[model samples]
Target: MEEREITIVKGKRSTPFSRGILAQTLSQAGAKPELAHRIASEVRAELLAEQRYTVEEEEVLARVRDKLIKKDALVVERLDKWRILRESTEPIVVLIGGATGVGTSTLAADVARRLNIQSVIGTDSIREVLRHAISPDLVPALHKSSYAIKPEDIRIPVKEENTTLYGFRIQASQVAVGVEAIVDRGLKEGTNLVIEGVHLVPEIILDRYRDHPNVCSLVVYLSDEAAHRSRFYIRALGTAMRRPAEEYIAHFGEIRQIHDYIVESARRMGVHTVENFSIENSSDAAVEIVANRVSGIAEKAARRPSSLLLDASARGG
Candidate 1:
């Protein structure tokens, strides 16, 4: 009559039944933690009533789906997505890129919080760090604002749009070295990070993580120039004490040029783009883009799995 007397048959072998696996599958399907546990508890009773020593893995899957169908019809797709999220062993890296005033900082913060990731870094912070380590005499671009960098240093002809693009790209390249280093370290440590900043351009990030299934890159932009300019106005009013937002306002044209350049590069390179017309829409789009990219942990851990197997000590939370 003891619990250990029951076994679940799985592909030519049987093991002591554990509801941990059931709860995990249900949780991945979008069941809340408490509900997942309650569902698993109820299902275990149903399985025992069969009065069999072993139940097929396929049968278990069927029962799990049935329970979900009764709970809510909409969760089927959510379940499929969660299944991949549950099974993937790799850390998730989300890189968000945008021009100075496109609101990516806010979007990235929300997405990171929603994803439950602990690391959120702004590339502007990276630029500030580089300024301390490198001298202006060595890297003049590092010392000047990307838009305000004197044309005397630029080798290219100073066409208005091209001039700004060229200047920003130079500063971006210098900052990119630090960004890539952080990414490399995170990959080795198996820690997830959400890095948001202007320097996370499609051109640079694509080179580093395009082939990496665990990393997703996104570029945010605003189609309406007037609205984009308004963002700078609102920002200036709030932080009037420290830095004058008017400088950004005065250089708005140059900022838009860089924004366009980045968007074009993202399109050419096939990096995902989210337009920040509204915060809710942009945030929802960003999360879905990431969820779509994460492969199932269960699928990858299925073959003689160690950590992902049905061990009660393993935390599915």
Candidate 2:
């Protein structure tokens, strides 16, 4: 017997139902990946047993919801919220800020994949572009690593701020120009983006967009010094030793200083901070924060009067 393929219909579109796609969606909405795959497989089996060849998207969602609620109600709520975020009119922007070796870039990529965001950029790339346009002599801090600013390159001498922080701020402030431009372009084009790097200092790049409904920012940090150092070794291996871990380890003090500064700034600014000891745990925490932020925006929009919503939409909010 030739088995029939299940077709899912949504509005004017019809596509083949895929357990892999459903599982990915479920995993993205806060469900454990293994459990998500199990649930997806079960859903497929149920449909096959019922001999249902055609189904509405809502029906599939309802079935998945029923199954998901039995195993975990919280994740089911997140799945609903994820759908709301998808239906939102504004583009999503996520800024991930952290010290070097704390895994901001890795977390940013993971979060982008979970949310299906197409644009992923790093602040380092922005800094590189700035280096080409600006002369090292003109802005010495811009040319050095955020954590490796030479004493002579320290242009700002704030009495209260330490030399390490002062140098980082000088470099980050210059990079902030590029970060802001990318953010503005994403907003204008309604393109979702994930921008992560040490240069995304909350006070520098986040202050302007922090209040925007579609913009969510968070900091990732490693609280334990030993674990933080280990990340550099792991990164070096991953990069085929092209970026020597010894170089980063040699400057661990400066890196940890910047780490503390960023973490403190996050706390002061009321931005969420994820202690990144484990990738899986940190990823869940990061995704939950983003989901909550998006869901809150969706709820507020839902409560507004249609006229106000329309007015806000027309104004490109």
- Which lDDT value does model 1 have at 65? 73
The sequence of per-residue lDDT tens digits that candidate 2 reaches over residues 43-83 is 88899999988887788889889998889998888788777
Tens digits of per-residue lDDT for model 1, 87-132: 4567778899999899998898877654556789999899999999
Worst 10 contiguous positions by lDDT, candidate 2: 304-313
Best by TM-score: 2
Model 1: which residue pairs collide?
84-296, 87-296, 87-297, 87-298, 88-296, 88-297
Worst 10 residues of 1 by lDDT: 303-312
- By how many angstroms RMSD does model 2 differ from the true structure? 5.6
Supply the TM-score for candidate 1: 0.70
Off-target runs (Cα >4 Å) in candidate 1 are 1-87, 155-161, 237-241, 296-317
